[model samples]
Target: MPDSGEVQAVKASNPGDSQVRVYAVAPRENADPDEIVDGFLEAMTSDDPGFATARKYLTRKAVRAWKPEESISVLTNAPDRDQADRPADESKGRTYPLSGRQIATVDASHAYQPNAPGEYNQSIHVVQQPSADGKSKEWRIDSLPKGLVLGEADFLRNYRSVNKYYFASGENWVVADPVYIRQRQDPVTRMDPVAQTVKALLEGPTGWLDPAVDSRFPSGTQLAPGVTTLVTDDQSTLKVPLNAKADRVSAVACKGMAAQLLFTLGDLTSVRVEQVEIQGSKGDRLCLLGKAQARDEYAPVRNAGHSENPYFVDEHGKLMTLSVGGRQPDRPTEVPGPFGKGVVPLKAVAVDREESHAAGVVQEGRELRVGSITADEELPPAVVTSSGVRPADRLSAPSWDGRGDLWVADRNPVKPRLWMVPGGQGERIEVSTPWLRDGARVESLRVSADGVRIALLVTKDHHTTLQIGRVERTFTDDGQTVAVTDLENAAPRLSSVTSVSWAGPSRLVVVGTEAGGVQQVRYVQTDGSTSATSVLPGLNGVDAVAAPYGEQAPVVADSGNDGIVRLVPGANWQPVVKSGGSPVYPG
Candidate 1:
């Protein structure tokens, strides 16, 4: 048997893979109150289905009241347990105080939200109770936290984040909704990771994303009875059996369901799910979808073929591009357009996803100009202009969505607003942002590739912070109206945020500083949670940062001292250009 506080590892039988499965030992006989507490905490981090082993250390009454599915508290490390100061009485029980630095929490909805490092204090009371046989007495916890408490390392080891795909509301393109699931078998449902992912997809998107996305699965749809383990066949195809609720879905809706499953299961690195075959209640085949078919029919915006090279404004205020992929020349070449020829000095530039059009902020940040990047063309007339005298109080850097729409923010204190230009040239529409009506100014903004979400850097009361808002569009007699609603702080831990950019479907790379700390660059999830490896290597004087949608692509940034630099995986930041600023990747 493994030693106390140690977990035993064995191969998983259901998946038939080399993945290790973790198990925790039950409470030992004659264990003291401290030992029982320690055993229970260790069990919380193991793969014991339904946490049965962990409950062995709790009293019968505690077992009946505890709800491990309520929430999960994650800390920086294992909590320290110390005996409380109160005198211990055998009849009154003993209290062990647990303390740690709390980092994040996963609620009952399986949505993970991060918090600034804060003190965590709780108590576990243990008392002598009759053993299960009622013949002897044993130390058992009578009162404790309602949910699991785990260290960051243990949490990462046991839980994995998976993106469950959902279609953008009223749109064909799918959006990624990230949620945490067990790395092995889930303790509650006794379902493996693949099954858990499929179940989550059926359950629908999280609260934050529900309003912006839609699930094609019919209401009350679920996995077939007695089906828990999901495995791919020799052909790399997964067959999913669903309950009667999904028996009547149309062929089109069935394909959407299969696409959702394909995308969700593709994120599980342990298994290869290339094709998905959906079965009805009576085992009748509903639809079959292959990876290629799904991509062609329901391709995500991120895979819409954005440029790989990073773009920036050179020392002469001309737009330039540099090749960062595979043995390419490090030399920076001016783009083939008026913006590249310095027709008008630029302060910032945003390239469309297809790299066919570019938007540049010129005339001292007061005018927004859109021009072609693939051919020589005169810089078009200013599409939008700001009356603010100071550059800092004027237009922000422009960002384009996959649908060929342009997003920019005007920070004129008297009339701050966010504008969207249809097809990068039509009349600009002011996107309603009620949250900004309270004297907050949008300093910068980036639209998600799906065009369903937008990230804004807002300033108020001398403090700048990062917030994400849902971009909701509604068509009526007035044509189409847009509003950015349900804004949430994406980086509350950062005392101030200077730059924010989307790195993936549900992740952002931000440059910010914590209270009483120096500036740093880190990755934060759209749900506000962060992982232990989120922080990048140190770099100084970073003015702006941009990351490509794919993880394998290098992150580019503009630094005051280092100029333009790129950070490749497994390496520190390397200077890309010694004279460029406002570096950015195609949106």
Candidate 2:
């Protein structure tokens, strides 16, 4: 019997801001068919370690055949028995068919994507099985599905996406690699939240993201032998012991490893990891100097140099920053640059992180120009021009990287390529991305605040899909070069993606159609897991969307209603500006 616990969304205070839900554990019982079925379903949706209890409902043969990780179906309701079945026989096996509508499916690799909301039927064959004491026969599932299924709310309660840190390829900084995990584990369980995170970091990234990210932990590295739990000491310090393999690394490398641990552990919402103490196999603390480090040098740069207010291009093609937080210039003020002068009929725009530069596409969408946000002089020259390509095949909305470089992709099917304007000016360098294939043309691109990733909305065969790729960079004596590689589908299940904005370091707000074929605004993790949070409410006719940083207010261009709408999480979308399209935030 499962505890009578109701599922509810608990807002996360971490940077990811994705909702975390709590699930109650089900008590063990294996008597009748209904009890066995109820307990099995409840256990499948729990974060129980080893799933030892769930196996109790199954016969020895069925337990061995079931592979819960093979797939997970998200449903809107609990699976109910097929009413058409005949009465159960006490001496012979009986099949209990269950059915529900699947909202999504999590594949073996744990990629959560939308699924067509239609009937999904499964079954379990049950019969009397000898008890552990051989004293009595109990109803046990003789056959079961290979994977698991749970209502949408239960899925949210048991699973969450967490970012484990890895050193960038250059080892100059750390990068977040998001992965799904249990939000809360049983206290008496072997998989401690902190320990599980450390183990995952050591295990490294998935096959698809391995090329784009690197780990400081050495190859074949493992946590110290017999290490199954991690708890802070009386002084509130987390002590993590690693195998002897890490002892040979230099102090700098040790520090980098510690930094990765610090950031990754800090992202755990329920844990308060004030400091991380890394230990060697011999039980001595390594990296003493780095152990008490308070600041995270690898965290994404936020508001430091970014505009405190949001901005949009008005109907007249002028750039204007909205007055937020009761700041000066009460009314919407035009930016102090060529965009403010309205000389170019701009169709789309983006500003650099420092709010010092701007990039936009001309009304014809055939040219991409960059200019100083505060410059009173003429607009910067067009850095990219498509002379023969159709206007619609010209360029996408520009995105500014943390390095102050501008990125845009030409939609020309004949020669489509992403271009990087280093420092937002000068030479137009073609960024080769072999994964942007199948005749897909870039529709929009937004760089993450960390600058190592880009979210892309691409159209192919008349359908649009959202994808994420790594921006690999190399610096030389002459300058820097960048390329977007390892492009992974972020919303492969989405049929149409109109807009995508970075809501947090490892999270994106995606507007698209679900596999069920309904359009809505929802949160998506970089690793392709859909957020359990409900879709943004009342978002209609959103042509574009812009977000400043981590879970901050996001504004949308409601082209259908001729107004700009602002999204307040858990609330309705409020109309902000009366007219605008292609709204954008400072890079």
Candidate 3:
């Protein structure tokens, strides 16, 4: 008989924040049908290596057909098991229905895709079969759903999210591709977390990011045969041994591959990977890269070291800066530009990544002006203008891309369009957005640092939702044609999204509400997944939210009741300015 330890109560924690492991036991001899079903479900949530114990409760045929790794369905809570409507006939079979509210799913690629809460119902059919001794009978599950089913708590406990780095298409900068990996050793591959992350990097980017990024590893490249564990040496260097496919690469490509490993393994806090050394199939060194070198050469947006101070429009409708670091300033200071000098009243403003220039919406949202922040230059002529009569129907807050380009949406319902201003001063180019052709209008917009993704607050059918679209630019003889394509919902759980900003390469901070729920602020991945710790403390009447690229930077927001406030981890929202609005971080 296998040890039948009781299943522990589930405790919610951030993904990758917990290290406790749950062990699963094999089914007891002659277990009844209900017990068999219960044990099977519990086993799926355990750290049982290879799920060998879980398979013991399944019939031989069922074991052959079940593919636990095909996908994972995460429910809001543990599924409820109840007897099916059909009569229980021991010889024929017994059926138990499993029901729950699904919250998200982890596909085969380990990409987490969250959906609005929805009902989930499935069945497990069990039948009595002869024991190994051919003298007794035992209950065994004969049919069940494909893949594994786990509650949100158990899923977070077992698996943790890790960012696998890949280079942006044709760019030296790296982009984060977040995916979940086992917190402990993987049950199926028996590989540790470090090794698992490395393998994931070699497998390439997920489906949603595939078109916008490229992996440095060669095709068919993989860890050497039978190598399932990776660790750092005393110098904090992780040596990755690759198969023959990656044995011969140029110096540049090798560095790119090393940079990917460095960032991916660096996300795992348990491992201190200061350096990464790539090894070829013949055990020869291909390339080596240090953490500092990788950051200087191919750093992600967060590591780019942009200014951390947040900017906001003060009560006087002028751009001001607030320092949220250790020592608070006496009060926010005006920027060194016409918009900051109050030459013209401003509604919204976005500072470039280098903090040298800013773009603002002036003239009651009818005009967008860009000016230098280092000099008190006159606001340039409107790079773009809208004919909409109402301020709400005109221009959105401008956003600066990492490439020094500016993006904004003309909310004029008559001719709604997305526009990009090259160098923040060139002639505005209309970007095509077919999805918005159906009468949807953009309420607000934020461009990612990679210059390839844009987060838009789109309103349609009297409802507003957050959508992420890919910015595809094609060079034509006439010039360059740009289009925003492949839009995906970034926050489906939120019935209405009022504000959004890029918090990280793959994460966005959004202000929205669930169906019939109160307004709230939360962190959402670009892919729409949310972690348990994603929600911040409650704040009332939040109109705009801004998150700096740096992880340690405080999140600033414009609250109607509290004015400008900032939220730091482990602390409540504190007031920054009593009469400020439209807080933003340098894009």
Residue 510 lDDT in candidate 3: 95
The residue pairs in collision within model 3 are none
lDDT of 2 by residue, 87-116 (tens): 655677777888977767776555555544
Ranking by TM-score: 3, 1, 2
Candidate 1 C-alpha lDDT tens digits along 1-587: 75579577973323112255557888888897779988888888788879999899888899999999889998878778887555555778889999999988998878888777899999899999888798989999999987989877777777888899999988888888889998887889999999999998898899988988999999999999988899999999999999999999999999999999998887899899899999999999999999878877786554545448889999889999988854333799999989989999999989998889999999899999999999997777888899987999999999999889999999998889999998999988999988887789999999998899899999988899899899999889977889999888889889999999999788999999999999999998888877767899999999999999877678999999889988988888888788879999997
Sort by lDDT, best first. Answer: 3, 1, 2
Per-residue lDDT of 231-318 in model 3, one digit per residue for the tens? 9999999999999999889999999999999888878988999999999999999999999999888874544565488999988889
Question: Which scores better on lDDT, 2 or 3?
Answer: 3
Q: What are the RMSDs of all candidates, in order? A: 5.5, 6.1, 4.6
lDDT against true structure, model 1: 0.88
Q: What lDDT score belongs to each candidate, Candidate 1 first?
A: 0.88, 0.73, 0.88
Please state the error at residue 228 of candidate 3 in Å. 1.1
State the displacement of the C-alpha of residue 151, model 1, in Å, after optimal TM-score superposition.
1.9
Instruction: Give me the runs in candidate 3 sitting further than 4 Å from their true place.
Output: 1-17, 85-89, 300-303
Candidate 2 local lDDT, residue 165: 76
